[model samples]
Target: MPLSESTVLISEVGPRDGLQSVKSVMPTAAKCAWIDALHAAGLREIEIGSFVPARRLPQMADVADVVRHALALPGWTVMALVPNLQGAEAALATGVHKLTLPVSASEAHSLANVRKTRADMLAELRRIVALRDAQAPAVRIEVGLSTAFGCTLQGPVPEDEVLRLAEAAAAAGVDEVGLSDTTGMAQPAQVRRLFTRLRAALGERAGAAHLHNTRGLGLANCLAAYEAGVRTFDSSQAGLGGCPYAPGASGNVVTEDLVFMFEAMGIATGVDLEALLAARAPLRAGLPGEPLYGMLPEAGLPLGFTYADGRLPRTPSIPRQAAA
Candidate 1:
């Protein structure tokens, strides 16, 4: 199906990426409620949780349950983060729509995050793909190369390395390969150039752009990737995540603001901004006292503007039922 002009797939990663980075744990029931509300807001895709070990990420200890709840929602593509072959196995067992494995482009970052060099991560990806092929061929595997723009430990990560990792991920048998600005050090020019190069190297296998607003360039970098032909974007609601290892950092690109930007530009995202904002309340209630980020929410919709529903004057309205 062709992508709708009024929408883009703003995959919410708050349950997985956002909550995992924080200290408190959101109850599984609350997580399910949040996911349900987001689906009600017209979010067709959601990264519900990660399949890592509870010892490693206690916040996602209920990933399997979250996946089950998300799958019960008709038409929603449930996604989860899987760090290695074992995590991939767990995700595949849940019958999720997609499983993303993080492969850092920066060798230093890769070693620090996953305790593996770049080559070692690629090998793990290959193993994960092979496992998926043997166990659950229907599940899609996505390799997200984190810290692609620049690294906290290794400054100015070479575009050559990023391109090489993209090529390696494609060769490693992943269905898709994405670039991530984990440290939020990306600029628009760098995003455009790298994504353009990645497209040339991996063709359609070139994956989504996972950007952070840590340095306040997340949206700009996203626009650059869009200009470079990326259709899918990974964002967190309320900007609710950050690198757990990277101290003093914020969350990924805010889903509310990102949807507002795309929908206002007349680019269909298939998401209701008002409903999307409403979904945030559960997130707030789940975490309580956590700082959420998004300019569109605080400032409200622009004056004299409209959304996909043809509502004018920029007033927030209840979401309409999606067409069958």
Candidate 2:
């Protein structure tokens, strides 16, 4: 059966989420090139990088520079992740179109990841939202209720608590709030239920679905969220990020595969699956020997596969990348 929804936003997160977890560092110019290619392929919103301190995440040391380059591109929404009020301020200074703050619903994960309790994180959200309103009201603030599905440290995150946080975030003055399966513990049923409850709680303020492909259910969970009325999604190109459950394990749902899923369903993504796949050239070149993963690239499109527009990828010719 065809999906009821006809449009979806595949927000690319490989620059921030994917690179941060990887040991190798992609150069700043290469990062800009990758972002350019991504935008060229029709991804409107791209999480170009994060605003954390360089000592903490060296891979994102030149975030401001990358953001500057992305800003120059026309018709693209530049997004960056901020860990707290401080990072949020820096991200705002970059004049980014969007800023994302991740708060873990799981108490243990909160303490482990950000070294703050859930209450403390909420407090930070309050302060960040206030700062954003006072300084840059034009910039959109997004709060990701991270680890909502389940936590690697605490496990079994309650649905009520997740909904409560979403309410709190909405009340805290954020422009939007979304659920994140940081540990890839989200099942399809859980996704549908939680998204429905979140929509009930926050109404139209409920935001994107940031899912991990851990255990190979990323695409399934995304579909479930879509059926629940979600239109925006966060995915890493080539599945570049790691799984928190295994600490250094594989990545988020592959962007190429996710786009393929939506386009194959007659849903419009506006992304050229072939061009998006070709964008991986810069990624591989940036992080040589990093071992990228994706289904579309390996198996190739199955026989008779066609995009939502009834067109196939431009060509089977592979994209070439500059030496790292």
Candidate 3:
């Protein structure tokens, strides 16, 4: 089947997911600047930061401020990660454009990571939806299904469990449910099957695929997901992130490589390769000495490499109103 529009959504997750894994705390100003640069590169949606406790993740201490700064940028969807109802309320208070709630498919991993069972997570989702609807119905709610493919604590997670949680999240009132390869254990075949089931279960409500490159199959899994009709993909700038709790896991898929793959395939991701690579400046400056990963920046783009018709991330002609 031919792609209808030849375009895809590449969501930058470096601010939230990437920074949370590393020890260095990027200043709020640097974060805002990095986000602004990413937007200039044509990225429409970016996970600015997670609304977690400062004591836990000091890297995102100024998430509220970051939200304000990001919303000021035109043609950007400023997204924040919220762990529970409290985080959701705080994020809502900041008037973020989008909020994500994470739920794990593995019961063991869920309990260990968030100290909540899958059932408990579902119940929390219900409360969160009520709060969001009553208080900020305009803010989009996405439930990120972590460990949907596999888990470090429990090993292989069941597909039925993943699908069940996705359906429950959709029913609980989340606008979308995205799959996460939290431990980097997903394979191409597995990605295809699970994403197919996910889209079938939720239709357009099936959101992004947040894949990791721990075993070097991140791109393969992403390709599989794309083939299964997933349009939104989450990647970290310079591939600078991973699950801290998942001991052996590596970083999230590299934004440059993912963009290169899609655009090279004659599919438009709307992300300018050179400009996106330049956003790494803030990332490197913010976390000096921290190892950044990616093949494109090191190798440089191919001589004749052209973007999907050499197009940049399409910015809307009209500026959007900030979520108030």
lDDT of each: 0.84, 0.86, 0.88
Candidate 3: give its CA RMSD in angstroms: 7.1
State which candidate has the highest lDDT: 3
Q: Could you tell me the TM-score of candidate 3?
A: 0.94
RMSD in Å for all candidates: 4.6, 4.3, 7.1
Given candidate 1, what's the lDDT at residue 297? 79
lDDT of 2 by residue, 219-315 (tens): 9999999999999999999898863333534569999999989998989888987778789998888888988888877766665667787887666
User: In model 2, where do residues sit more than 4 Å from their true spots?
Assistant: 1-4, 243-250, 316-324
Residue 116 displacement in candidate 1 (angstroms): 1.5
Cα lDDT, model 3, residue 92: 93
Question: Which residue pairs show collisions in model 2?
Answer: 241-251
TM-score to native of every candidate shown:
0.93, 0.93, 0.94
User: lDDT-based ranking, best first?
Assistant: 3, 2, 1
Error of 3 at 1 (Å): 20
